[model samples]
Target chain A: MFLAFVAATLVITYFSARKSSGASAYFAAGRRITGWQNGLAVAGDYMSAASFLGIAGMIAMNGYDGFMYSVGFLVAYLTVLYIVAEPLRNSGKYTMADMLAYRLSPKPVRAAASLSTLTVSVFYMIAQMVGAGVLVRQLIPGVSYEVAVVGVGLLMVVYVVFGGMLATTWVQIIKAILLMSGSIFLSVLVLREYHFDLGEFFTRLTAIESTAPDGTKVVRNFLTPGLIFKNPWDQISLGMALLFGTAGLPHILIRFYTVPDAKTARSSVVWAMAIIGLFYIMTTFFGFGAASLMGPDYVQANGGTNMAAPELARKLGGEVFFAFISAVAFATILAVVAGLTISASTSFAHDFFTNVIHHGKEHQPGQEVLVARIAAFVVGALAIVIAIILGPGVNVAFLVGLAFAVAASANLPVMLFSIFWKRFNTNGAVVGLLVGLTSSILLILISPDFMGENAIFPLKNPALLSIPIGFLAAIIGTLLSKEVPSEDKFVEFQVRANTGLGSEKATEH
Target chain B: MNDPQPSAADKPPIDWHRIQRDPDFSALVRSKARLVIPATVFFIVYYFALPIGVGWFPEFMEKKIWGDMNIAYFFALSQFLMAWVLAAIYVVAASGWDRSERTLLAKFGYTSKH
Candidate 1:
């Protein structure tokens, strides 16, 4: 089944690459995707293996605290819709750097933005590949972890290097449908097992009993928080990351430009919110149902919480259901890696190659696409190497958490200031990117994820500290910097970003 | 993707300052702000309320509503509804904003040549 999905996406890449021979087509799918299509693609791009496997596993292990992630992920869309989506779609050509450089000096601003984009995407890609290696190995007995990682890497490279955003978008749309159908099916199955009695389901889920070390009977309620988020401040920090992070995610932000206009961008967020929101709500049933049916002990024995959803599938319909859902999870990773590779490659070719290295010269029709294809292959190779070295046992959820922290801290502040503040100069944008990137990474390195238990940074997520530094660095740097944006630059940007006055027109073909 | 757009520079340069001051533009911006600002604030506060509730006051959040269905579950579920309802509302309100934008665009000669 997984091979079948891979074969289908490769076919899509073949056809998409033919027309995707130019910079515009390669980068933004010729800006021809409709709102609903882009919406599904965005859903596909944003919902990583973490959302599919990690969240269910967390619930199977931690309960209400895990549900907190779902809420944070969903509500974060409001920030995107209200503050950034239309503005980004109107102003940005291909990459996040374009949005930042609208008012700031282009070369330095694009360079900084590209650095941040690559960092975030690479971190995210590595974690996905590692998780994919482990998940694939679990499903199929013969494939070694190293081989699985390399296979995923090559497939993603082909999708982006050839098909670019067009193939990536279609792959994501298919992944979203498969994921939603699988989850909905599992949710129904879970409900049916309890005779569709919600109360009965909850009762069974929470009534999971065990014996303590002293042989005392212990009843564990899987319905509460605190089991995971023992620290109160950690919850707030995580909340901040999830709330502010999506607006800064490069792959997600670029999806806005894949549609034709600002109005389509705005509508796409709504469509995404609807699909993503429904999927997350269904996860509540899926996660809780997993706990009720399989119990945490069974899930933990089978290799922790990531196995919860799959284990529940096995119980519901034997081996066939498990294989189908496992295939869907693999497809989820493929779609995400393809999305990340495109975003990273687009940034490399568009911002770094064209702007910084080539001094803003127009590339011949296929030149930019060629550079982008090479970048995708390089990025995929780097991620695969990292995934192989790290091995399959690494906790990937933290890496994802770190990616969000960096995005919120580094990218969101610059993005918000660039689009909103008139006095936000080139100095601010560059400094914001550098400071946001460094502080979040440094903090994470010192935190428990990298260092052992006792750490320099108390919080697991650095966003609580790093987000403020990002904003303040931008604000102070702007106030202290010598270069001020010319009056014309601000006005032109406001007009373009706000009203879509001079937005890029999409090619219909 | 990298270079400043050629078509934008080639076309008649928009009087950005005039558009900035246009009443229709102001109305659109102001009205969208009116809805978006309050809605954004309400939802953020509302979203934080649940996490804070779960984090800070677990006993209260864990209070069972129906059998083992806790208050926390309901509150969390409500957020899904809140997002969908708010997003739906924003899209509907934006349609009116889109109409006004088109009307003003034609007035200001900002219509697309393509």
Candidate 2:
């Protein structure tokens, strides 16, 4: 089944590659994805291994605190659905740069956005690659760590280079299907153990006692929520980060450009919300179900809590079910990695090279596409090498938080301003991006993860502080800077963004 | 006027300010904001309540409503239902906006492709 999936996707890539020769097709899938298609693509692209293995494991280990992450993630999409979706589709061409370029100066805005986009994608990709390396090695025996990392990296590069958005979309769609069905099967199987009685299932689950890592007999109540964040304030801050951060995610935002117009974009977000929301609710089942069936001892003893879902499958239906879910997780990682690679490469080639280096004057569509393909290879190689060197020992949790924080602080504020606030000039965008990026990174670097003994920062996530700074910096910089981008330009941008008048040309693909 | 597009040299002049005055365009914007802004604020508040409740009132959240299932877990599941219902409502609301947009486009001598 795993090899068949890989083969089918490769075949899809082959066909899409031939059709994806145009500049629009290369970067934006010719803006042809229907509402339902784009919706599936969005959910597929967005739900990573973290949601699949990490959160389920979190619930297995810590209980309700782990489930909170899923809630935050699902809720964040409302921001995307309501605020960002329409304006983004109406204005953007290829990258987020296209949206900002509407009002801000193309050179500086694209330059800053390119840097931010690459930063988020690189950190996110490295984390996934490292996790992929560790997980794949364990799941598929005899596959060395280096081999796992390299295999995933190369496959990701190939997907982006050949299929671009078209192939990547299908890969994600397929992954979404496999993951949802697998989770549903797992949930149903778990429920079956209690004769399909949710109440009985919960009663027995909480009644059971499990062993913890410290070799203590523990009775874990998967019902209550406090294992992760003891402090209410910290919980609020983490919630703020996730809620705002999702809108700024580079890979997620880029998918909006794949649809034709604002209408499709809006509808797609609704579709994504339904799919993602339902899947997450089932994940709550997966998490609680794992703890109930396999117990925390099994989860931890095998390989921390990351093994919860797979272990649960093994317990319920033996090896075949375990292998099936493992394959689905593998596909999940691959789809996310490919999605990240394409977005990062698009930023590097289209935004950085074609726009910034060539000052938006280059008309070489073929050259840009070639550059993007090369960029994908380089990005994949770098991520693989770094993941191998890091060897899964790096503190990826901190980096994920940092990625979301940086995105929320840097990207979200500027995007909101660019679309809504008329006075948002180029200086504000550049300053806001720099401030948000640096502050988030600096805080994380000093936090307990990096500084350890001498860490000064109190919180694990920095959105509570840095997000305000991002918004304030943009406002203050716009007021302070003497550079006023032309009024006529702002008017043109406003009209275009509002009315979808002079956005990218649509093809009848 | 029938072109519906700008040829390279002879681009159609769009009176953006006039469109701002056009009832169809303004109505579209107003209706969208009226629905979206309120929905967003409502969801954010409703969503944030769960985390805060779970964080501060763990004991209360742990209070079992049926069997051993706590109030918190049930509340979280309700969010799933709420999200789906909101999406369904938005589809209906968006269809109306979409219709207005189509009429406005046609009135402006543009084709609604679908």
Candidate 3:
């Protein structure tokens, strides 16, 4: 029933998107999006299935630390709000490639920026798709996993092909509101079940999980154990990646472009943070609500700890609540995927076709628009293929962590240095991006999470090692490089990016 | 074609010292900083400090709060409330800075408000 509603929603959204006028509309809702509207959309895009479902599940399982992911995610936007939001809105040409090319020659920088965008986007999409598969299978018990994947893929493509960013952003805005409302409603219901007595609730929750033969209390994993780090180090590493990662995500960064100026961009992050924070708080209740009310026996009977929150909802809210949440979960996945495809398409259209391939030569606006639409379809298809290969073995939440780590390691340093530090030359930008990307990937591959038979390395949690390495690499690379950019080129870039000086006469260079 | 270059004294032709002293520039910096600093501090604590607190004091965190809701649970839930407060703060603070900041940005070669 919920799938039917989402399919209908996607169809209507897709048709609405078909009216996108040009590349601007396709890429960034034609930059006509209102500040409030874009704020909701950004919240929607950033808050994925992992955030909505996984955070609650983790908290239910791991205790306090699992819920930390939610706090880290919301706080991460502070870094975005303070450092990157305005600069990105002030300086970006289109994709992040524009920012990189702003300070240096196109060549390898454009290529590298484009590559980085693709790598992060693909990983992100896989996590979303996998989450969709899991949710769909749960919602409709009889449906095969493969069918769920195909259904989600088709729905996503339909939305991206027709709606562009305009459709996608609105979908995100709606999804964000729905997701927040749904979680709050469920939390309220859960609280009501315990008569708002949280103390009794915890005792009951723990007592239920404490049923061992020897009476040894089996700590119901409220969140996956702090296997990553202990106390301060774990918090610091999570904080570093999440705090900085928001600014680096390609899709999130591009949302600033949909707004009017630096002020608007800044304002949007603040709004996004508030909306995101509210949702995270709601997730904690859902997590604990699941733990206290549903009990360990129910969670273990269903599957394991991950099912705690969802089963708790089933117990409290029953079938109707389950159906509503199931629909919202689908909407969450769709909105995020649509935004990702639009961002990727914009990168292809702006960075590759118009800028690099054409070498600043102007193409017909229609031709550019066509290319963007085509690229959206291509990205959606590629993500679908990746999702199929990943299959059922993957955990959606873990994959999201990987995406956050990679984005923090690679893009944050380059973007930050390019804006604030003048000495950061082209060579340094290229090297910094490469080092960040390589190190994060290397760390993830070898870590215990993705390690073992498929493991690329032996250590887990690369934050302590990889993050510093990336930052140092960027700083050192910039310091060692001697070739300063041409004064004239710098002046032109400054004029175009920083001032309202007359680049309005769009000339084919 | 080679263009004549300015001497060292003539370089940095704009009076940066005068610009710095301008009321408009000072107001611009003050207004922007108000929003930027609080937001930065919040990130430092919420993302950096809160998680560390929980991670370090796991035992204390796992204990119940109102009933079943523990300190960890409360922190996680309160986080979203904090985000909304920060967002509202950002809107009010950023809007105040917009006009003056724009003036500074123009002086520095600002373009494309859209």
Candidate 4:
């Protein structure tokens, strides 16, 4: 099943490679993707292995606290639809930095934005890479963690380097369909176990019996809150990060550029919200099914938390169902990493290399695409090496959470201020990005996740403090700087953003 | 990829100041802001209420409305519905904005291909 998925995706890459040529085609898929197509790709890019396997496992183990992650993930899209999507599609050409560089000083703003983009992407990519390794090893015996990591990494590199965004988008769309189908089937089987009785399902969930760490059997209600998150502040902070993070995600933002116009972008966001919202709601059935039917203790003893969904499949539908679910998980990881690699490489080539280093000019035609391909290879290799070094024991969930924190704090504030605030200048953009990036990392280092009992920060997620600091830095930096704000450029940007008067159009075939 | 013309050169010179000063453009912006700002604030407040309610008033939130379905679990499930409804409303509202945008562009002598 896994090999069949791999072969299907490679065939997609072959066709995409034949069609991809110029910078526009390679980067934005010729801006020809329909609303629903881009919507599926966006959902595919957004839902990672962490979301699929990790969230289900979390709910299976921690109950209500795990479901909190789902609420925040879907709500985060409103921020995207209302504020980020249309303006970004109208104003920017390639990457998130393109939007910022539209109104601010190109070199400084592009450099700062590119750094944040790479930081968020690398953090996100490493988590997915580590997850791929751990998951593949468990699903298929005789596969080492290091070997799995390298294989996934190389495959992503091949997708980005040869087929570019077109292949990556299709891979994600296909993965999304498979994931939704798998989840639906699993949810159905779980419901069938209870004869589709909601009362019985909820009754079982309320009293989940498990063995304690001290060898005592305990019965806990999975419906109650505070299972995993002890502190209210930690819960609120995580809520803030996830509530605002999706808007700032580089890979998610770049998908807006795949469509023809702002209206399509608008419709695509609606489609994504529908698909994503439904998928998250179904987690209740499968997650609680794992806890109520198989029991958390059994799941933990079998293969730990991340295997909750697959274990439930094995229990209810036998080995064949388990294998199919495992392959879907593998596809999930590959699609997410491919999306991340393209966004990172696009930022590096477009913002850092072509715009920042070469002063917004490519030395030759097709040079930007060439540079992006090289960057994709380098980024993939780096992720593989780091995942191998860190090994599978490192917490993949923490890294993904940190990526959201960085995005919410660093990328979001800067991008928002650039579009809405006329006084926002190069200094503000630079300061906002640097301060947000550094503060989130610093707070995480001192938090309980890293420092154990000696932790200074009480909250596990840093967005509660760091996001406010990011917005403040932008405001203060803009006020303190002596540079004069250019009204003409701001007016131009507003017109384009509002009416799509001079935005990039879809390329003709 | 087929076209040799760079993307930048294809765009005609736009009278940004004129569009910015137009009353129709202002109305369009005002209409969007009226819906988006309040809708955003409402959803954010509604979303945060879950964690706050669960954390601060666990006993109250734990009260079962229907067979083991506590307020906490029920509220979390409602968020998915809230998001979908809000998105549908936004999409519906945006169609009006699209019409206004088209009229504004037409006044400026540019016809949108889409």
Top-DockQ candidate index: 1
Q: Could you give me the TM-score of model 2 versus the true structure?
A: 0.94
Residue A414 lDDT (model 1): 91
Once fitted onto the true fold, the runs of candidate 4 whose alpha carbons sit more than 4 angstroms away are A394-398, B1-12
Taking the tens digit of each residue's C-alpha lDDT, what string does model 2 give over A1-509?
66777788898899998887677888888888888998898999877877888788888777777777788888888788778877787777778877887767778888899889988888788878866776777778999889989998888888998889889998989998898899889999988888988778777666547775577897866676786677677777778888899999999999988887887888888888888887888776788888777777777777565667878888887888888888888888899999999998998888889888876655764888888899989888888887888775443443465678889989999999988787789899999988988888787778766778788977777788889998999899888988877766556666556566655555655
Which one wins on TM-score? 4
lDDT tens digits, residue span A1-118, model 1? 8789989989998998776757788899999999999999999988888787878877876566788888888999999998889888888799889888877789999899999999
- Segments of candidate 1 deviating more than 4 angstroms: A210-218, B6-10, B112-114
Q: Going through the candidates in order, what is chain B's TM-score?
A: 0.88, 0.85, 0.63, 0.90
What candidate 2 gets wrong by more than 4 Å, as runs, is A207-214, A363-365, A393-399, B1-10, B112-114
Say which docking band candidate 1 falls in: medium
RMSD of each: 2.0, 2.9, 5.7, 2.2
Clashes of each: 0, 0, 39, 0
State how far residue B50 of model 2 sits from its true place (Å). Answer: 1.6
**Ten residues in sequence with the least summed lDDT for candidate 1 chain B:** B1-10
Per-residue error (Å), model 3, residue B14: 14
iRMSD in angstroms, per model: 2.4, 5.1, 7.5, 4.1
Per-residue lDDT of A1-509 in model 3, one digit per residue for the tens?
57676766676675666666665666666666777788898999999977876766666655556666777788677677766776566556457777667667676677677767877888888888887877777778898767888788777777777777777887888888888888888889888987987665556555436344475767554433363344466456656767666778999988887765565666677678778877877776787677666654555556344345556767888888877887887888888988888777777776777667876555575776677778878887788888888885565666777788778888888887776566777787788888888888888877767656675554445566677777888888877888886655454444333332222111111
Number of the top-ranking candidate, with lDDT as the measure: 4
lDDT of each residue in A1-509, candidate 4, tens digit only:
98899999999999999988898899999999999999999999988877878788888886888889889999999999999999999888888888888877888888888889988998899989988887788888999989989999999899999999999999999999999999999999999999999999999888888888898988999999998888888888999999888899999999999999999999999888888988888888888899998888987886677778888999999999999998998899999999999999999998899887887778999899999999999988988888898787654655777799999999999998988898898899999999999998899989988899999998899999999999998888888898866899899889889988778888888
Name the lDDT value of residue A174 in candidate 3: 82
